[model samples]
Target: MKYIALFRGINVGGNRKVDMKQLRTLFESLGFSQVSTYINSGNILFESELDTKSVLMKIQNCFHNTFDFEIPTIVKTENEMKKIAKSIPEEWQNDPTQRTDVAYLFPEADSKKIIEELPLKIEFLEIRYIKGAIFWNIKRENVNKSQLAKLISHKLYKSMTIRNVNTARFLAGEKE
Candidate 1:
């Protein structure tokens, strides 16, 4: 299946650096084909016959063996990703210019738990849980400033990755 693997803590601040070449090689070792990376921050798109969880574990193992590190990897199938895109809050959709982000959550999370505890200090930013991901309508000013970002990381227990709305759109196959 075609899937997007969102890797955490790679190529950040020059630490945990992973070259796109080696990244592609790791995935290829796992028997994934058509592998491609976007930007420098470990947004990988590839196809594999393994299940999502196994894919995650295999990548994690490969990372540890190759780089001596354990990086969190979240894998989502193309269909599930489509559901996530559809789950974005309507208000955010109407105003694309607003600074926004999408936090991809673990597939097994309890949605109700997240909704109840969402941070609300940032008025312009809101969160929606669709399928297994959190779609955030982050105000541009509040994008990097809001407590919601921290809340998401905390609430999700660092099992998620926050990518800018534009990047998310591109990964989701939306036109610029």
Candidate 2:
């Protein structure tokens, strides 16, 4: 199976620095094939026969052992990513006036419960959920008014790893 592992909070603000080269090496060392990293934010694309659950377990253990730190990792199969990318409207993007984000939720928390918890301000938000993730958008100017913008302080935030639409598209193989 092919999987994309999105590591949260790494290489941010000079904290938890992860070198992509070493990351690739680490994934490769796990016996995964075609291990490759996307950007410096810790998105890794790799293939393995192991199931997604098994893959996540192996990567989490290996990552902590190799990097000496623990960070939440969200894994999605290539098919799942493709569906997510396809679900996104063509117009939503991370640009001058609009911002789109897909929050890949951890297994324990990927549910309608979190979606229900969102106090969405329709004027500033557009949100939807399908299985493992939630897609949301907010006008850049009204970002502060969007519940998603303040999600960082919400307890449910810890259960998700967010990516901008651009990153999501690239990972889903929608961008070259």
Candidate 3:
């Protein structure tokens, strides 16, 4: 099956540096096929007969053993990723004025609980839960003032990985 693996907290702020080339080599060595990485932010596409959970665990363990850093990995089938990409609200698509992001929730995460924990409402922010992911939009103009910024320190933040709408779409093969 074709899948996309999203790695969290790598190659950011000069921390947890992981070479994409080496990552591809590792995946290849692990018996995956057609492995490819995008942009250096730990997005990998590959084909494997292994189940999603097994793939996720294998990558995470391999990465930690090789790099000495714990990298959380999320694996989703191509169809799942495509569904996620298409789930974005129509109004958020191609809108330059809005900063849209999709938060991939951990397998153990409770989407309903997370949503309930978030602020009751924020005028400049819109959030939706779909298929174990959180789709959110923040007006660019209000980014600095939006309470969504507080998410960084929120406990739930550690349980999910965020990707920009464009990156998410690209990984989903919605864009060439």
Candidate 4:
């Protein structure tokens, strides 16, 4: 099956410095086919017959062994990503004033509970859950003032990996 694996908090701001070339080599070494990485943000596309859980475990272990740090990985089949890319509201897709992002939830995350825990309402933020991910947008102008912006330091942030909507679409093969 074809899959896209999103690795969280790696190769970002000089922190968890994972070289894409070596990462791809590791995937190839694991017997995955057509392993390709996207834009240095740790998004990998590959084909493997193993189930999602197996793939996740293998990749996580490889990363830990190679980097000496635990990097959370989220795997999604091509079909799943396609559906998620299409789930964003059209208005948000075209709105230049908004910054749209999709957060791929960990298998153990309860989407309903997370949604319930969010503030009752935030004028500059809009959030929705589709499949196993959360699609949210923050008004560009109000991002600094938006409560949702505080999630970076929140405990909930640890359970998911996030990507800009455009990047998500690109990973889903819906965009160049």
The candidate maximizing TM-score is 2
Q: Who wins the lDDT comparison?
A: 2
What digit string (tens of lDDT, one per residue) describes model 1 on residues 1-176?
89998887789899988899888887898899999999999899999888988988888788778887778888888787767776665456425457566777765563656655665564656766675677667656666666654574455556567787667777777634
Clashing pairs in 4: none
Candidate 4: what lDDT?
0.84
- Model 3 scores a C-alpha lDDT of 0.85
Q: Estimate each model's TM-score.
A: 0.82, 0.93, 0.93, 0.91
- Model 1 misplaced regions, further than 4 Å: 89-97, 107-110, 141-146, 152-157
Ranking by TM-score: 2, 3, 4, 1
- Model 3 scores a TM of 0.93
- Mark the regions of model 4 whose C-alpha exceeds 4 Å error after superposition: 94-96, 119-121
Q: Report, for every candidate in turn, its global Cα lDDT versus the true structure.
A: 0.74, 0.88, 0.85, 0.84
* Model 2 spans with C-alpha error above 4 angstroms: none
Candidate 1 has a TM-score of 0.82
For residue 136, model 4's alpha carbon misses the true position, in angstroms, by 1.2
- Considering TM-score, which of the candidate structures 1 and 3 is the better prediction for this target? 3
Per-residue accuracy of model 3 over 68-90 as CA lDDT, tens digit each: 76888888999999998898975
Ordered by lDDT, highest first, the candidates read 2, 3, 4, 1
lDDT by residue for model 4 (1-176), tens: 99999999998889988899998999999999999999999899999999988998888788778887888888999999999988887566536777888889987774667866654346667888877798888778877776676677777788888898888999999889
Better-scoring candidate (TM-score), 1 or 4: 4
